[model samples]
Target: MADTNAQEDFSKLTADLAVLRADVAKLADTLTTLARSQGEAAADAVSSRVRQGKAKAEATASELMDEGRAAYDEARERAGKIGGDVTAVIERNPLGAVAAALGVGFLIGLLSRGR
Candidate 1:
Protein backbone atom coordinates (compact mmCIF):
# COMPACT_ATOMS: atom_id res chain seq x y z
CA MET A 1 0.00 0.00 0.00
CA ALA A 2 2.82 2.43 0.71
CA ASP A 3 4.42 1.78 -2.67
CA THR A 4 1.10 2.48 -4.40
CA ASN A 5 0.72 5.80 -2.55
CA ALA A 6 4.22 6.89 -3.59
CA GLN A 7 3.40 6.17 -7.25
CA GLU A 8 0.26 8.28 -7.05
CA ASP A 9 2.16 11.24 -5.53
CA PHE A 10 4.81 11.06 -8.27
CA SER A 11 2.11 11.07 -10.98
CA LYS A 12 0.42 14.14 -9.53
CA LEU A 13 3.73 16.07 -9.33
CA THR A 14 4.54 15.18 -12.96
CA ALA A 15 1.17 16.47 -14.13
CA ASP A 16 1.68 19.74 -12.25
CA LEU A 17 5.14 20.24 -13.76
CA ALA A 18 3.73 19.67 -17.26
CA VAL A 19 1.08 22.30 -16.73
CA LEU A 20 3.66 24.79 -15.43
CA ARG A 21 5.88 24.24 -18.50
CA ALA A 22 2.93 24.95 -20.83
CA ASP A 23 2.12 28.16 -18.97
CA VAL A 24 5.76 29.33 -19.17
CA ALA A 25 5.85 28.68 -22.92
CA LYS A 26 2.69 30.71 -23.46
CA LEU A 27 4.14 33.62 -21.48
CA ALA A 28 7.37 33.58 -23.52
CA ASP A 29 5.37 33.72 -26.77
CA THR A 30 3.32 36.63 -25.50
CA LEU A 31 6.45 38.54 -24.50
CA THR A 32 7.99 37.99 -27.93
CA THR A 33 4.88 39.41 -29.63
CA LEU A 34 4.85 42.44 -27.34
CA ALA A 35 8.51 43.20 -27.98
CA ARG A 36 7.98 43.09 -31.75
CA SER A 37 5.01 45.45 -31.54
CA GLN A 38 6.88 47.93 -29.35
CA GLY A 39 9.89 48.00 -31.68
CA GLU A 40 7.72 48.81 -34.71
CA ALA A 41 5.98 51.60 -32.81
CA ALA A 42 9.29 53.18 -31.75
CA ALA A 43 10.64 53.08 -35.29
CA ASP A 44 7.55 54.80 -36.65
CA ALA A 45 7.75 57.56 -34.04
CA VAL A 46 11.42 58.26 -34.81
CA SER A 47 10.70 58.40 -38.53
CA SER A 48 7.91 60.91 -38.04
CA ARG A 49 10.05 63.16 -35.85
CA VAL A 50 12.87 63.14 -38.37
CA ARG A 51 10.55 64.26 -41.17
CA GLN A 52 9.19 67.11 -39.04
CA GLY A 53 12.66 68.30 -38.11
CA LYS A 54 13.76 68.34 -41.74
CA ALA A 55 10.77 70.42 -42.78
CA LYS A 56 11.33 72.94 -39.99
CA ALA A 57 15.02 73.29 -40.85
CA GLU A 58 14.19 73.96 -44.49
CA ALA A 59 11.68 76.67 -43.59
CA THR A 60 14.10 78.37 -41.19
CA ALA A 61 16.88 78.37 -43.75
CA SER A 62 14.62 79.95 -46.37
CA GLU A 63 13.54 82.68 -43.95
CA LEU A 64 17.14 83.45 -42.99
CA MET A 65 18.14 83.71 -46.66
CA ASP A 66 15.38 86.21 -47.37
CA GLU A 67 16.39 88.33 -44.35
CA GLY A 68 20.03 88.32 -45.42
CA ARG A 69 19.10 89.42 -48.95
CA ALA A 70 17.02 92.35 -47.62
CA ALA A 71 19.84 93.46 -45.32
CA TYR A 72 22.37 93.34 -48.16
CA ASP A 73 20.14 95.46 -50.41
CA GLU A 74 19.70 98.09 -47.69
CA ALA A 75 23.44 98.25 -47.02
CA ARG A 76 24.17 98.68 -50.76
CA GLU A 77 21.73 101.56 -51.02
CA ARG A 78 23.24 103.32 -48.01
CA ALA A 79 26.76 102.90 -49.44
CA GLY A 80 25.69 104.42 -52.77
CA LYS A 81 24.23 107.49 -51.03
CA ILE A 82 27.40 107.96 -48.96
CA GLY A 83 29.54 107.74 -52.11
CA GLY A 84 27.44 110.44 -53.79
CA ASP A 85 27.76 112.72 -50.74
CA VAL A 86 31.55 112.29 -50.65
CA THR A 87 31.78 113.14 -54.38
CA ALA A 88 29.76 116.31 -53.83
CA VAL A 89 31.93 117.38 -50.91
CA ILE A 90 35.13 116.86 -52.93
CA GLU A 91 33.72 118.86 -55.81
CA ARG A 92 32.83 121.79 -53.54
CA ASN A 93 36.26 121.98 -51.80
CA PRO A 94 39.18 120.40 -53.64
CA LEU A 95 41.85 122.08 -51.41
CA GLY A 96 40.11 120.89 -48.23
CA ALA A 97 39.91 117.37 -49.68
CA VAL A 98 43.63 117.39 -50.39
CA ALA A 99 44.43 118.50 -46.81
CA ALA A 100 42.13 115.81 -45.34
CA ALA A 101 43.70 113.07 -47.48
CA LEU A 102 47.22 114.08 -46.39
CA GLY A 103 46.19 114.03 -42.73
CA VAL A 104 44.58 110.61 -43.10
CA GLY A 105 47.69 109.25 -44.86
CA PHE A 106 49.96 110.51 -42.08
CA LEU A 107 47.74 108.90 -39.43
CA ILE A 108 47.71 105.59 -41.31
CA GLY A 109 51.52 105.64 -41.53
CA LEU A 110 51.83 106.32 -37.80
CA LEU A 111 49.41 103.50 -36.95
CA SER A 112 51.21 101.09 -39.20
CA ARG A 113 54.54 101.93 -37.53
CA GLY A 114 53.01 101.23 -34.09
CA ARG A 115 51.71 97.87 -35.26
Candidate 2:
Protein backbone atom coordinates (compact mmCIF):
# COMPACT_ATOMS: atom_id res chain seq x y z
CA MET A 1 0.00 0.00 0.00
CA ALA A 2 2.83 2.40 0.85
CA ASP A 3 4.52 1.78 -2.51
CA THR A 4 1.26 2.26 -4.39
CA ASN A 5 0.48 5.58 -2.61
CA ALA A 6 4.01 6.87 -3.31
CA GLN A 7 3.68 5.98 -6.99
CA GLU A 8 0.37 7.75 -7.26
CA ASP A 9 1.73 10.87 -5.57
CA PHE A 10 4.74 10.88 -7.87
CA SER A 11 2.54 10.68 -10.96
CA LYS A 12 0.32 13.45 -9.73
CA LEU A 13 3.32 15.64 -9.04
CA THR A 14 4.70 15.02 -12.54
CA ALA A 15 1.39 15.92 -14.11
CA ASP A 16 1.13 19.07 -12.08
CA LEU A 17 4.68 20.11 -13.12
CA ALA A 18 3.78 19.68 -16.79
CA VAL A 19 0.71 21.86 -16.44
CA LEU A 20 2.71 24.52 -14.58
CA ARG A 21 5.34 24.57 -17.33
CA ALA A 22 2.67 25.06 -19.98
CA ASP A 23 1.08 27.88 -18.01
CA VAL A 24 4.47 29.61 -17.63
CA ALA A 25 5.07 29.35 -21.39
CA LYS A 26 1.69 30.81 -22.12
CA LEU A 27 2.34 33.70 -19.70
CA ALA A 28 5.66 34.46 -21.40
CA ASP A 29 3.96 34.55 -24.83
CA THR A 30 1.28 36.87 -23.53
CA LEU A 31 3.88 39.24 -22.06
CA THR A 32 5.83 39.28 -25.33
CA THR A 33 2.74 40.16 -27.30
CA LEU A 34 1.78 42.87 -24.81
CA ALA A 35 5.25 44.41 -24.98
CA ARG A 36 5.25 44.43 -28.78
CA SER A 37 1.90 46.17 -28.93
CA GLN A 38 2.94 48.78 -26.37
CA GLY A 39 6.10 49.59 -28.30
CA GLU A 40 4.15 50.04 -31.51
CA ALA A 41 1.64 52.30 -29.77
CA ALA A 42 4.47 54.47 -28.38
CA ALA A 43 6.01 54.83 -31.83
CA ASP A 44 2.68 55.83 -33.32
CA ALA A 45 2.13 58.49 -30.65
CA VAL A 46 5.54 60.00 -31.32
CA SER A 47 4.93 60.08 -35.04
CA SER A 48 1.59 61.82 -34.57
CA ARG A 49 3.15 64.45 -32.30
CA VAL A 50 5.89 65.09 -34.82
CA ARG A 51 3.36 65.63 -37.59
CA GLN A 52 1.34 68.04 -35.47
CA GLY A 53 4.49 69.98 -34.57
CA LYS A 54 5.51 70.21 -38.19
CA ALA A 55 2.14 71.58 -39.20
CA LYS A 56 2.21 74.14 -36.41
CA ALA A 57 5.69 75.29 -37.38
CA GLU A 58 4.63 75.63 -41.00
CA ALA A 59 1.63 77.71 -40.01
CA THR A 60 3.79 80.01 -37.87
CA ALA A 61 6.28 80.47 -40.69
CA SER A 62 3.48 81.29 -43.12
CA GLU A 63 2.07 83.88 -40.76
CA LEU A 64 5.48 85.48 -40.33
CA MET A 65 5.94 85.69 -44.08
CA ASP A 66 2.58 87.36 -44.49
CA GLU A 67 3.39 89.87 -41.76
CA GLY A 68 6.74 90.61 -43.40
CA ARG A 69 5.06 91.26 -46.73
CA ALA A 70 2.55 93.62 -45.14
CA ALA A 71 5.31 95.51 -43.35
CA TYR A 72 7.29 95.83 -46.59
CA ASP A 73 4.26 97.14 -48.44
CA GLU A 74 3.57 99.75 -45.77
CA ALA A 75 7.21 100.88 -45.78
CA ARG A 76 7.19 101.16 -49.57
CA GLU A 77 4.01 103.25 -49.48
CA ARG A 78 5.39 105.61 -46.86
CA ALA A 79 8.63 106.01 -48.79
CA GLY A 80 6.65 106.87 -51.95
CA LYS A 81 4.65 109.49 -50.10
CA ILE A 82 7.80 111.07 -48.60
CA GLY A 83 9.48 111.03 -52.03
CA GLY A 84 6.51 112.82 -53.60
CA ASP A 85 6.50 115.48 -50.87
CA VAL A 86 10.22 116.12 -51.33
CA THR A 87 9.75 116.41 -55.12
CA ALA A 88 6.97 118.95 -54.66
CA VAL A 89 9.11 121.04 -52.34
CA ILE A 90 12.08 120.92 -54.70
CA GLU A 91 9.89 121.90 -57.64
CA ARG A 92 8.30 124.81 -55.75
CA ASN A 93 11.71 126.27 -54.87
CA PRO A 94 14.31 125.26 -57.41
CA LEU A 95 16.78 128.00 -56.37
CA GLY A 96 16.32 127.16 -52.69
CA ALA A 97 16.85 123.49 -53.41
CA VAL A 98 20.10 124.20 -55.24
CA ALA A 99 21.36 126.38 -52.37
CA ALA A 100 20.41 123.68 -49.81
CA ALA A 101 22.20 120.98 -51.77
CA LEU A 102 25.39 123.07 -51.96
CA GLY A 103 25.23 123.82 -48.25
CA VAL A 104 24.76 120.16 -47.39
CA GLY A 105 27.66 119.13 -49.59
CA PHE A 106 29.95 121.68 -48.00
CA LEU A 107 29.02 120.54 -44.48
CA ILE A 108 29.53 116.88 -45.35
CA GLY A 109 32.93 117.58 -46.88
CA LEU A 110 34.02 119.52 -43.82
CA LEU A 111 32.89 116.75 -41.45
CA SER A 112 34.52 114.00 -43.52
CA ARG A 113 37.85 115.91 -43.66
CA GLY A 114 37.87 116.19 -39.85
CA ARG A 115 37.39 112.44 -39.58
Candidate 3:
Protein backbone atom coordinates (compact mmCIF):
# COMPACT_ATOMS: atom_id res chain seq x y z
CA MET A 1 0.00 0.00 0.00
CA ALA A 2 2.81 2.41 0.68
CA ASP A 3 4.37 1.64 -2.67
CA THR A 4 1.05 2.22 -4.41
CA ASN A 5 0.69 5.60 -2.74
CA ALA A 6 4.17 6.63 -3.79
CA GLN A 7 3.46 5.64 -7.37
CA GLU A 8 0.28 7.73 -7.39
CA ASP A 9 2.07 10.79 -6.03
CA PHE A 10 4.73 10.47 -8.69
CA SER A 11 2.12 10.34 -11.42
CA LYS A 12 0.41 13.46 -10.10
CA LEU A 13 3.70 15.29 -9.90
CA THR A 14 4.49 14.40 -13.52
CA ALA A 15 1.11 15.68 -14.67
CA ASP A 16 1.60 18.91 -12.77
CA LEU A 17 4.99 19.42 -14.30
CA ALA A 18 3.55 18.93 -17.77
CA VAL A 19 0.89 21.52 -17.10
CA LEU A 20 3.51 23.98 -15.82
CA ARG A 21 5.59 23.45 -18.98
CA ALA A 22 2.55 24.16 -21.16
CA ASP A 23 1.77 27.31 -19.17
CA VAL A 24 5.36 28.47 -19.52
CA ALA A 25 5.24 27.89 -23.27
CA LYS A 26 2.06 29.95 -23.53
CA LEU A 27 3.62 32.72 -21.49
CA ALA A 28 6.64 32.77 -23.69
CA ASP A 29 4.49 33.09 -26.79
CA THR A 30 2.57 35.96 -25.21
CA LEU A 31 5.78 37.76 -24.28
CA THR A 32 7.22 37.34 -27.77
CA THR A 33 4.06 38.78 -29.33
CA LEU A 34 4.03 41.70 -26.92
CA ALA A 35 7.66 42.53 -27.59
CA ARG A 36 7.11 42.45 -31.32
CA SER A 37 4.14 44.80 -31.04
CA GLN A 38 6.03 47.22 -28.84
CA GLY A 39 8.96 47.27 -31.22
CA GLU A 40 6.66 48.04 -34.11
CA ALA A 41 5.05 50.86 -32.16
CA ALA A 42 8.43 52.32 -31.27
CA ALA A 43 9.58 52.15 -34.87
CA ASP A 44 6.43 53.83 -36.04
CA ALA A 45 6.86 56.61 -33.52
CA VAL A 46 10.44 57.19 -34.62
CA SER A 47 9.44 57.22 -38.27
CA SER A 48 6.73 59.75 -37.56
CA ARG A 49 9.16 61.98 -35.69
CA VAL A 50 11.63 61.76 -38.53
CA ARG A 51 9.00 62.78 -41.00
CA GLN A 52 8.04 65.74 -38.88
CA GLY A 53 11.64 66.83 -38.56
CA LYS A 54 12.15 66.52 -42.30
CA ALA A 55 9.10 68.62 -42.97
CA LYS A 56 10.26 71.27 -40.54
CA ALA A 57 13.73 71.38 -42.05
CA GLU A 58 12.29 71.69 -45.54
CA ALA A 59 9.99 74.48 -44.45
CA THR A 60 12.86 76.34 -42.81
CA ALA A 61 15.02 75.93 -45.91
CA SER A 62 12.22 77.21 -48.09
CA GLU A 63 11.76 80.24 -45.86
CA LEU A 64 15.48 80.96 -45.93
CA MET A 65 15.51 80.71 -49.72
CA ASP A 66 12.66 83.18 -49.94
CA GLU A 67 14.46 85.55 -47.63
CA GLY A 68 17.63 85.24 -49.70
CA ARG A 69 15.73 86.03 -52.88
CA ALA A 70 14.17 89.07 -51.30
CA ALA A 71 17.55 90.25 -50.06
CA TYR A 72 19.10 89.77 -53.52
CA ASP A 73 16.30 91.73 -55.15
CA GLU A 74 16.69 94.59 -52.70
CA ALA A 75 20.45 94.66 -53.14
CA ARG A 76 20.14 94.70 -56.88
CA GLU A 77 17.73 97.62 -56.74
CA ARG A 78 20.00 99.54 -54.39
CA ALA A 79 23.03 98.87 -56.58
CA GLY A 80 21.18 100.13 -59.63
CA LYS A 81 20.17 103.30 -57.88
CA ILE A 82 23.69 103.89 -56.61
CA GLY A 83 25.08 103.26 -60.10
CA GLY A 84 22.70 105.85 -61.58
CA ASP A 85 23.70 108.39 -58.94
CA VAL A 86 27.40 107.78 -59.56
CA THR A 87 26.88 108.12 -63.29
CA ALA A 88 25.10 111.44 -62.78
CA VAL A 89 27.93 112.73 -60.56
CA ILE A 90 30.61 111.59 -63.01
CA GLU A 91 28.80 113.27 -65.87
CA ARG A 92 28.38 116.50 -63.91
CA ASN A 93 32.09 116.73 -63.06
CA PRO A 94 34.24 114.70 -65.39
CA LEU A 95 37.57 116.19 -64.22
CA GLY A 96 36.60 115.72 -60.58
CA ALA A 97 35.72 112.08 -61.26
CA VAL A 98 39.09 111.53 -62.94
CA ALA A 99 40.93 113.10 -60.01
CA ALA A 100 38.95 110.94 -57.54
CA ALA A 101 39.73 107.81 -59.54
CA LEU A 102 43.45 108.66 -59.54
CA GLY A 103 43.39 109.23 -55.78
CA VAL A 104 41.59 105.87 -55.18
CA GLY A 105 44.15 104.11 -57.43
CA PHE A 106 47.02 105.60 -55.45
CA LEU A 107 45.42 104.45 -52.19
CA ILE A 108 44.86 100.96 -53.53
CA GLY A 109 48.47 100.76 -54.71
CA LEU A 110 49.75 101.76 -51.26
CA LEU A 111 47.51 99.20 -49.52
CA SER A 112 48.52 96.37 -51.86
CA ARG A 113 52.26 97.15 -51.73
CA GLY A 114 53.04 94.41 -49.15
CA ARG A 115 51.19 91.74 -51.15
Candidate 4:
Protein backbone atom coordinates (compact mmCIF):
# COMPACT_ATOMS: atom_id res chain seq x y z
CA MET A 1 0.00 0.00 0.00
CA ALA A 2 2.80 2.42 0.88
CA ASP A 3 4.70 1.47 -2.24
CA THR A 4 1.68 2.21 -4.40
CA ASN A 5 1.23 5.59 -2.78
CA ALA A 6 4.91 6.39 -3.25
CA GLN A 7 4.70 5.48 -6.91
CA GLU A 8 1.67 7.72 -7.37
CA ASP A 9 3.42 10.58 -5.64
CA PHE A 10 6.45 10.18 -7.88
CA SER A 11 4.25 10.11 -10.98
CA LYS A 12 2.54 13.32 -9.93
CA LEU A 13 5.86 15.00 -9.27
CA THR A 14 7.16 13.88 -12.67
CA ALA A 15 4.11 15.29 -14.42
CA ASP A 16 4.44 18.57 -12.58
CA LEU A 17 8.10 18.80 -13.57
CA ALA A 18 7.20 18.19 -17.21
CA VAL A 19 4.59 20.93 -17.08
CA LEU A 20 7.06 23.33 -15.51
CA ARG A 21 9.63 22.57 -18.21
CA ALA A 22 7.06 23.24 -20.93
CA ASP A 23 6.11 26.54 -19.33
CA VAL A 24 9.76 27.59 -19.14
CA ALA A 25 10.27 26.72 -22.81
CA LYS A 26 7.19 28.70 -23.81
CA LEU A 27 8.35 31.70 -21.79
CA ALA A 28 11.79 31.52 -23.42
CA ASP A 29 10.18 31.51 -26.91
CA THR A 30 8.02 34.51 -26.01
CA LEU A 31 11.02 36.42 -24.70
CA THR A 32 12.96 35.65 -27.89
CA THR A 33 10.11 36.90 -30.05
CA LEU A 34 9.76 40.06 -28.00
CA ALA A 35 13.49 40.79 -28.13
CA ARG A 36 13.62 40.35 -31.91
CA SER A 37 10.63 42.61 -32.45
CA GLN A 38 11.97 45.27 -30.15
CA GLY A 39 15.39 45.10 -31.82
CA GLU A 40 13.87 45.65 -35.27
CA ALA A 41 11.90 48.64 -34.03
CA ALA A 42 14.99 50.03 -32.32
CA ALA A 43 16.81 50.02 -35.65
CA ASP A 44 14.17 52.32 -37.19
CA ALA A 45 13.35 54.55 -34.21
CA VAL A 46 14.38 58.22 -34.50
CA SER A 47 11.98 59.67 -31.92
CA SER A 48 12.34 59.55 -28.14
CA ARG A 49 9.36 57.16 -27.60
CA VAL A 50 10.70 54.42 -29.79
CA ARG A 51 14.14 54.81 -28.34
CA GLN A 52 12.74 54.63 -24.83
CA GLY A 53 10.71 51.53 -25.56
CA LYS A 54 13.63 49.84 -27.19
CA ALA A 55 15.87 50.74 -24.30
CA LYS A 56 13.36 49.38 -21.81
CA ALA A 57 12.95 46.14 -23.72
CA GLU A 58 16.67 45.67 -24.04
CA ALA A 59 17.16 46.35 -20.35
CA THR A 60 14.42 43.90 -19.44
CA ALA A 61 15.90 41.23 -21.71
CA SER A 62 19.34 41.76 -20.21
CA GLU A 63 17.94 41.48 -16.72
CA LEU A 64 16.07 38.31 -17.58
CA MET A 65 19.16 36.76 -19.13
CA ASP A 66 21.21 37.60 -16.08
CA GLU A 67 18.60 36.10 -13.80
CA GLY A 68 18.42 32.98 -15.95
CA ARG A 69 22.18 32.59 -15.93
CA ALA A 70 22.30 33.02 -12.18
CA ALA A 71 19.62 30.42 -11.72
CA TYR A 72 21.50 28.00 -13.97
CA ASP A 73 24.67 28.60 -12.01
CA GLU A 74 22.89 27.93 -8.77
CA ALA A 75 21.40 24.73 -10.14
CA ARG A 76 24.81 23.59 -11.35
CA GLU A 77 26.29 24.29 -7.96
CA ARG A 78 23.57 22.29 -6.26
CA ALA A 79 24.02 19.45 -8.71
CA GLY A 80 27.74 19.42 -7.99
CA LYS A 81 27.06 19.28 -4.28
CA ILE A 82 24.63 16.42 -4.81
CA GLY A 83 27.18 14.61 -6.93
CA GLY A 84 29.77 15.00 -4.22
CA ASP A 85 27.34 13.60 -1.66
CA VAL A 86 26.59 10.71 -3.96
CA THR A 87 30.28 10.00 -4.32
CA ALA A 88 30.65 9.93 -0.57
CA VAL A 89 27.74 7.53 -0.29
CA ILE A 90 29.23 5.35 -3.04
CA GLU A 91 32.48 5.19 -1.12
CA ARG A 92 30.50 3.69 1.70
CA ASN A 93 28.64 1.30 -0.59
CA PRO A 94 30.57 0.92 -3.80
CA LEU A 95 28.29 -1.31 -5.88
CA GLY A 96 25.03 0.56 -5.24
CA ALA A 97 26.71 3.90 -5.87
CA VAL A 98 28.14 2.73 -9.18
CA ALA A 99 24.73 1.54 -10.37
CA ALA A 100 23.03 4.71 -9.21
CA ALA A 101 25.66 6.93 -10.81
CA LEU A 102 25.31 5.13 -14.13
CA GLY A 103 21.54 5.52 -14.07
CA VAL A 104 21.76 9.20 -13.20
CA GLY A 105 24.44 9.89 -15.85
CA PHE A 106 22.28 8.20 -18.49
CA LEU A 107 19.22 10.26 -17.58
CA ILE A 108 21.23 13.49 -17.47
CA GLY A 109 22.76 12.80 -20.88
CA LEU A 110 19.34 12.13 -22.36
CA LEU A 111 17.91 15.34 -20.95
CA SER A 112 20.90 17.47 -21.92
CA ARG A 113 20.62 16.52 -25.61
CA GLY A 114 17.43 18.53 -26.28
CA ARG A 115 18.76 21.83 -24.97
Best by lDDT: 3
- For each candidate, the alpha-carbon lDDT, in order, equals 0.98, 0.98, 0.99, 0.94
lDDT for predicted candidate 3 compared with the true structure: 0.99
How do the residues 1-115 of candidate 2 rate in per-residue lDDT, one tens digit apiece?
A: 9999999999999999999999999999999999999999999999999999999999999999999999999999999999999999999999999999999999999989954
TM-score of 4: 0.45
Evaluate candidate 4 by giving its C-alpha RMSD to the native, one decimal: 38.0
Q: Write the per-residue lDDT of candidate 3 for residues 1-115, one digit (tens) a residue.
A: 9999999999999999999999999999999999999999999999999999999999999999999999999999999999999999999999999999999999999999995
Q: Model 4 over residues 8-100: C-alpha lDDT tens digits?
A: 999999999999999999999999999999988887675678789899999999999999999999999999999999788888999997898
lDDT of 1 by residue, 26-94 (tens): 999999999999999999999999999999999999999999999999999999999999999999999
Which residue pairs collide, candidate 3? Answer: none
Each model's TM-score?
Answer: 0.75, 0.76, 0.93, 0.45
For model 2, how many clashes?
0
Model 3 TM-score on a 0 to 1 scale:
0.93
**TM value for model 2:** 0.76
Candidate number that wins on lDDT, 1 or 2: 2
Question: Which of the two candidates, 2 or 3, achieves a greater TM-score against the reference?
Answer: 3
Position 65, candidate 1: lDDT: 100
Candidate with maximal TM-score: 3
